[model samples]
Target: MRITGHHPLWRIAAAVLGGYAFTWGFIALGMAGAFALGMSFHDAEHLTAIIGFLIYLVLFLWAFAARSLARVWAVTAGGALVMAGAASLIQHQLT
Candidate 1:
């Protein structure tokens, strides 16, 4: 999975997109988990921000380190979707 056959800019773009996906996805998932645990809104937000950075760094590394740009997107998008769905479900349950 050599990163090839495209402009370097495209590769950089993919990495940037992947980084954003992972960063937000992790934060959303963290907040979702906190909500599922019945945490207050303020506490959930603070906790998500506190833990999200470290998680983002690891996920950002994972995104750029992928052998294929497409794989980076697939994993990031899939993870985000799953987390979003879970968050929605948890919120629904609470309401």
Candidate 2:
């Protein structure tokens, strides 16, 4: 049983590392948006943290089940950037 073809390693990496990055971005955006929308700091933090766990699970599974590694990487990495950037903008506006 030599499961050594295609890009299993890449998929695993994306599932773990990429998923983590994407989840982090999601948390950042959620925190900022929630706070800006009048949520308490601790409330927003706890809320986003809870949602982020579910998001990470979904993304991890999707990364493995998805057919296109490129798309997975793109979405995870690109989405992270976009979300983080949005969070940054929100923070700037709030400040």
Candidate 3:
């Protein structure tokens, strides 16, 4: 499907906003989960939350800048995978 220039502009904007919303929502949920688990945000475990939020933000921006749906999906998914992998490796080494 072809997205017109103007249409893609709106889609990009929506992607950015939607991505931001999703990131914040996840952060809130993470914080809530921590609280429920009796863990404070001051704990080292909360580092994962920060990494996840940054990954989501980057993926959203990647998707927004994409020219096509396929491209957007590919870029976003790839970014997520890379981010997740890096986070896991770093966390593993830190522990």
Number of the top lDDT candidate: 2
Residue-wise C-alpha lDDT for candidate 1, range 1-95, written one tens digit per residue: 54456745655665566556666776776777787788887898888887777766666676566667677677767777777777777667777
Return the number of clashes found in candidate 1. Answer: 0
What are the RMSD figures for all models against the true structure?
A: 2.4, 2.5, 7.9
What TM-score does structure 2 among the candidates reach? 0.93
lDDT of 2 by residue, 1-95 (tens): 23467579989999999999999999999999999999999999999999999999999999988878889999999999999999999999999
Candidate number that wins on TM-score, 2 or 3: 2
Pairs clashing within candidate 3: none
After TM-score superposition, the amount by which residue 74's alpha carbon in candidate 1 deviates from its true location, in angstroms, is 1.3
> So what's the TM-score on candidate 3?
0.51
As for TM-score, the candidate ahead, 1 or 2, is 2
Candidate 3 — what's its lDDT?
0.57
Residue 34: error of model 2 in Å?
0.4
Misplaced by over 4 Å in model 3 are 44-49, 61-95
Q: What is the lDDT of residue 31 in candidate 3?
A: 50
Best TM-score goes to which candidate? Answer: 2
